[model samples]
Target: MRDPNFSHKQMSAPDRLPTRGLPSNSVTPSGRNGVSSRGGEINERIADRIVRVQWDLTNLKDFWKVHSSPHRSERLAEYLNAELKVLEWMPFQAYDQNERVDYLLLKNFLRNQLSEVHRDAELDSKVLAFLGGFFPLRMANMIEARQRVDDLYHKKAAESLVECTKRIILVKELIVSEKETAEPIVALRATKNLEEFKGHWQEWYNFYDGYDPLFSYWISEPYPKLQKALQDLIDTIKKVCLGLETEDEDTIVGEPIGRSGILEALDTEVIPYTPEELISIAQKEYAWCETEMEKAGHALGFQHWRSALEHVKDLYVEPGKQPSLVRDLTREATAYIRKHDSATVPPVCAETIQTFMMSPKAQKMNPFFLGGDEIIVSYPTQTMSHEQKLMSLRGNNIHFARATVFHEMIPGHHLHMHYMARHRPYRQIFETPFCIEGWAFYWEMVLWDSPSWQKTPENRIGMLFWRMHRCARIIFSLKYHLGEMTAEECVELLIDMVGHERATAEGEVRRSVMGDYGPLYQAGYMLGGLQLYALRQEVVENGDWSEKEFHDTFLKANQLNIELFRALILGEELDKDYKSQWKFYEEIKRD
Candidate 1:
């Protein structure tokens, strides 16, 4: 479990959205981007277009009617602003909201193309191709765009993941609906969207579910209000879908009305920690880490990082001699963080490393030091203080520093993300979350055996207790998602397992309800670990393979589902046979 390559201050996984057609930062009025001329007109136009699309997309018939009109496709494209409010607002609510929004966006986009085909066969054929070709691209584009944006603005980026979850849910629902249906037309469309959608959804759920570890950290928000809003929305949606009458106000779903309570709680909750109290906790935590490193000795660094580096280096260079890997490692590590930072990097030569070192990527790295890479940490704004929010990498360094370096940097996420990011074509960004996050979580235990951390029984006990806490978290996700656990039960489990004296754990549960079927958080790591282990054995039996090569191959695959990766790596093609079979039905419909 000892990983030496881990660095502190690492950030979380990248966004899976594409940045194409995004207005340059300069065009933004915030001045964060360099394109600002005609800002007022552009803003107004963008706003107007978003409202129109949102309005038109609500009715399935309207969505299809308008989009299918001749000469309207280009007009529709002109109004589609990916950076507008519609895109931004969709991520903050329940799964249903996400579903409605994503489906509408896609449905409308597809709906616009009706004129291209008139016959049933033609319609079916075109729809299948459009869903197959366009939806995956759209999903990937959205994920990539958000990833870049998150790199620039950490807290906002972190908060945006709620939206990412929404988008994934959208794709997942579409995939399920497409695959299971008996209808020929529906099946054809399913053939188009379901493959990539299922692949990406499984990847997100299985791997990246636990990216924001500090989601367990307490903030000043009232957990109840957000829960109520989410519940109310769900109830209302169910009623409407069932054809039951609802109050007039209920029709306007997914609005952040009455959110002031959540906001107020964020601004004023009193956990009552003195500055001295935090520093005292930090001292205890820091000492604990030191003890772990000592026990782990060289294996901590080598296993987590250097060994892996040597392996990959062996692919090109001499086996035991030191290579220039460290310099490239440092540069790559820093650039990863610097790219993910929302705040500007100043040109001060004196503290350049230290300056970029405060990024979320760096904070995530603090957990992995003996492993020798940097961590990348990220969380929503409320968990971060205002100053920290503004400066991004600012505030109490020791807190994020410890978390990032120990958890994500050296032995952790940085190594994980770097490998994954490099391996695939751009589309793979949307593919790998569970593996990325699961690997980081696995190392949390690995560090406990480090020499520097085992000095005190309290440190050992604390780390053990924390692991138990994480275990509880995983169980909660499984039970909740599988429909066996209720929100109340989830809350009770958190209190019992993690000593939920802090509101952070409760907040995490509340957020979980808004994403996927349940808490598939730990499912990624637990399941992914099993998958990786099995795959490793299979490869070993087939051909002699190094762990380093496996690790590199794993990471470079860009967070693809282990199953999908297995197929691709084992020299199997993507399942075009099933899709080809699906195309037959489309051809049948067309003729």
Candidate 2:
């Protein structure tokens, strides 16, 4: 189930509001901030009040810490009073459209928080009313409100079902209109739109099933039917866009950027390796890894890999023993990077990273580390089955942990996020996984060559495991998307070629295909890495530039397709029809 507040894409203003029930006045007007006729004074007053309330709430020292304390009710009451004070000041009808939307969203956020903190049914009703009044068109809010009302009143479930039917009809209209567009580009756009709509609708249904027992009981049968209808529409649209029935189809369906569309979208050159080429690369790495494992007194099989992983796990802090391991490792990596002057590590980034245990429900997903200002690490719990425990430990051993810590934190994702947030905020819409994932992968390669980080053969083997995994990702993901491989085949490839445990390989495949990541995201790790490596060799290694100089320049340039990045750094002329010419992987010498 999707968290209502969480979105994988960066939240736009409209996204912050409820998707279904937005009021007529909710949409922001084009010219200016859509100032109301009442005057600027009122708008300023409303904005000022919201700002002050936010400041007051945020400024309270240890406020969040107090949320889980024994006196939580008392703290919540005080917080609600402060929030009410802000709400009292808001002139919802008098403010500009932008200000009004902001005011409503803020109000909704506060109300929702209060309801959750206090478990107050009355407050929940009030929230429902507030959402319904402002966001009347949104199906998600309507369903939620209906459920809450039904819970409170013991009403018949027919009303919510009717509302669901209405929503389905409306969506059907959208789907039909979407398919009416016959032009390839327009059809492709429609495919994306439908996919997004289906995802959101599925989330709405899943959220109800997971969170609201009453709603789930009534809607259980209808939910699967609705989901299938959505999927059928999506599949139909994809078929038309990809020109599957045509003999000389040009488009890749759902992907507008061509066969190398992912690369083009990332402003990168086409990936140099074919499926066979990538498989060969993975095989070579596999053989090398086998040699390394033998030297470490392990053999080249699943059992030996498991034993080697256990040995490495034993060397590190035992799972669930202490929270200090990640933090200590992060600090050590930061210090090393700074000492070598490899790249600038911002103080804010180093200080702001927080760590937490991965939840049991999320264990099957096998999330090793998720990056933001905070990095989330998954570790095995006491309640986990032996297989689950093995899966967790197999992929997050001491050497693997050390190899990936910098990639998730420091001069990797955290630093990249920090710099981009401050310097090139507008370029966020152009974000592609290639540039983002590539940058981190490039650093892994860089540190591999640096004796300071990969000081031992074990560390090198750990690093190589991930490198080989990245290569395998490109091969398997591309094959899956091209209809040459199945999800099971992809899983087997990971297990056989990358030495992943059976469960771990399955989880990896699930994450790559069924998760929020795009079709090309798996490939981005290695392909992007190769793009950066080639660019570095051409510019920094050949031209007059130090490693630090090249890295600083690259980071500051913000996220761009590797091709445009090259053009910007090299001062090359760019054309609208520019296509990738560089075959980066072909230049590599494999022993």
TM-score to true structure, per model: 0.34, 0.57
For candidate 2, write residues 1-591 as lDDT tens digits: 122342223325311212322234532333435333322223345446554555655655233222222243455667666665435434454443234433443443455445445543333333333222221234334343443443422124435445555554554454456633345434444444445545555655665566766766676765566556545645654554344443322222232223443333223223444545555655665566566555553432334654554455455557765356677778888898799897777777777887877776665665475665678887778897987777777677777777788888877888888878765443443456778899988888878766667446467657767877887887787777666776678888888776776766776777776566766688777777777887777766754456786677667656666655654545443332345565666654434
lDDT string, candidate 1, 1-591, tens digits: 112232111313332211222223333324233322311232333324334444543433333222222223433333433333233332212222112223233323332222223322344445444333333344344344433333323344344444444443443344444442223333323333334334443443333335644432321122223223323433333343322244332111111112222222111111122222322433443345444433433433443322322222123222211113333444543453345441122233112222122333332222112231332223223455554343322211222223334334433555554544443333232333345555555445434433433223323333433444455555665455444566568768766544432233444464455333212334344334434545655653345444444444455445444444444444332211111111111111100
lDDT, candidates in the order shown: 0.36, 0.58
lDDT of 2 at 374: 76
All candidates: CA RMSD (Å):
24.0, 17.2
Global Cα lDDT for candidate 2: 0.58
Per-residue error at 461 for model 2, in Å? 2.2
**Which run of 10 residues does model 2 get worst, by summed lDDT?**
248-257
Best by lDDT: 2
Q: Tell how far residue 423 is off in model 2, in angstroms.
A: 1.2
